[model samples]
Target: MTQNCFDDGDEDDVPEWADRVMADVAREVRRRRKEMKWSAQDLADRCEAIGFPIPRNVIANMESGRRAVLPLVEVMVLAEALYTHPIRLIYPVGYVEEVQQLPLTYPVDTAQAMSWFAGLNEDFRADHRMLRHHVAHRTAVERAFFAVHSEERQRRAAESTVDDIEQAKALRTQADLAERTARAKAELYQVRSDIYADGDPLPDLPDELVDVDPPEGYERDTD
Candidate 1:
């Protein structure tokens, strides 16, 4: 329910709150544009290159705080134009330590809000299924991708730096150990992902994981 203000006869706070949020966004957009040496026209051109075609006048209005409400699509295109993640513009994480999560709500830590927005953690009031979904998918993604990707990099580094035989051998051994750990995690991720993939034998995985099958007859002893 909107509380009516006594003097102005305003019944809604959302418009004011929304304008404040957009002011923050405008400040950020202008800062990023200036940092990258882009004028309003340049920023607009980048948006056009991204196929959204936000006109220079629109960019001017947004950056000048004349526009308060931006569509979600504009947020995405602006982030890409500025070479930033959408969430960074959505919530100014480093610029402010806390943010009002919503109008009339107490401020929460920016990191907490970011994590909640990213589906990295559960809200107490969130649906139980979604909570489980985030956890399971996050675990599966990390297990299926992280170690294997790191080890692959290490292996490539080892291959390229073969000038020192002993050093190269040490790096390869480290990579082999990491690969063993990756195999264990990938097997577990497959089990956990069945609920998502409806028991498909080959659950969807990152391309790197697809190419990272354990060598045949290679025992995976982590000891």
Candidate 2:
């Protein structure tokens, strides 16, 4: 409900209550932007589409305590485009209590918690370095980064186990073949050694020579 103060025909540079209301509205809008992940450009685009014609600088002003409330329809459009209830754009603090009541256990060390908070708004260079370290150290940040891909890793491990087993069987078969080849080679050498006799003399002739028969005719006459 916009009241027409001009009816009194008295001009005040700024109204005290209006100033406080603007401040509260600005803070709520800022908080809602953070919650909805909407950039100034996103809000501007929505306002433009809804015939509000809000410049990005005006959105920034409204979100930084520099401007009063936007028109009601503009707030509604922003809420709809951000996929949130319209009241949230005007009173984002409503969600703070719920966020505080969440079941997550805050870190015990205040310094560690502050460090994590600082990383959220870090400069681009520090952000890159922090992400690199997070991956290199396999910290919680890295785990959360890869949570979506963990199932794929498990599947790959399962397939690799099958290949590993086949490779092990192949190695064992190769070892067995090598052992059999070595034994056959050894037996061949032993047979060759027996034939050569290490340069020893050959065995004597057959003992049949000792009983050589006389002339066939003389043997028959004696009988």
Supply every candidate's count of residue pairs whose N, Cα or C atoms clash at under 3 angstroms: 0, 0
Tell me how far candidate 2 lies from the true structure as C-alpha RMSD in angstroms: 36.0
The candidate maximizing lDDT is: 1
Model 1 score (lDDT) = 0.69
lDDT of 2 by residue, 16-135 (tens): 435533544566666667767889887788778877667889889877766756677766676666667665544344332211111123212323333343454356436474353433
TM per candidate comes to 0.66, 0.32
Q: What does the lDDT come to for candidate 2?
A: 0.47
- Each prediction's RMSD over C-alphas, in Å, is 7.3, 36.0
The local lDDT score (0 to 100) that residue 19 gets in candidate 1 is 68
What's the lDDT for residue 52 in model 2? Answer: 61
lDDT by residue (1-223, candidate 1, tens digit) is 1122222334455576576567667777888999999999999999999999999999899988777578888989999999998888867777766665566655677778778777766454265554565556567667656666666777777767757986678696866869676675766454444443443233355675554333451333233
The C-alpha lDDT values of all candidates are: 0.69, 0.47
Best candidate (score: TM-score)? 1
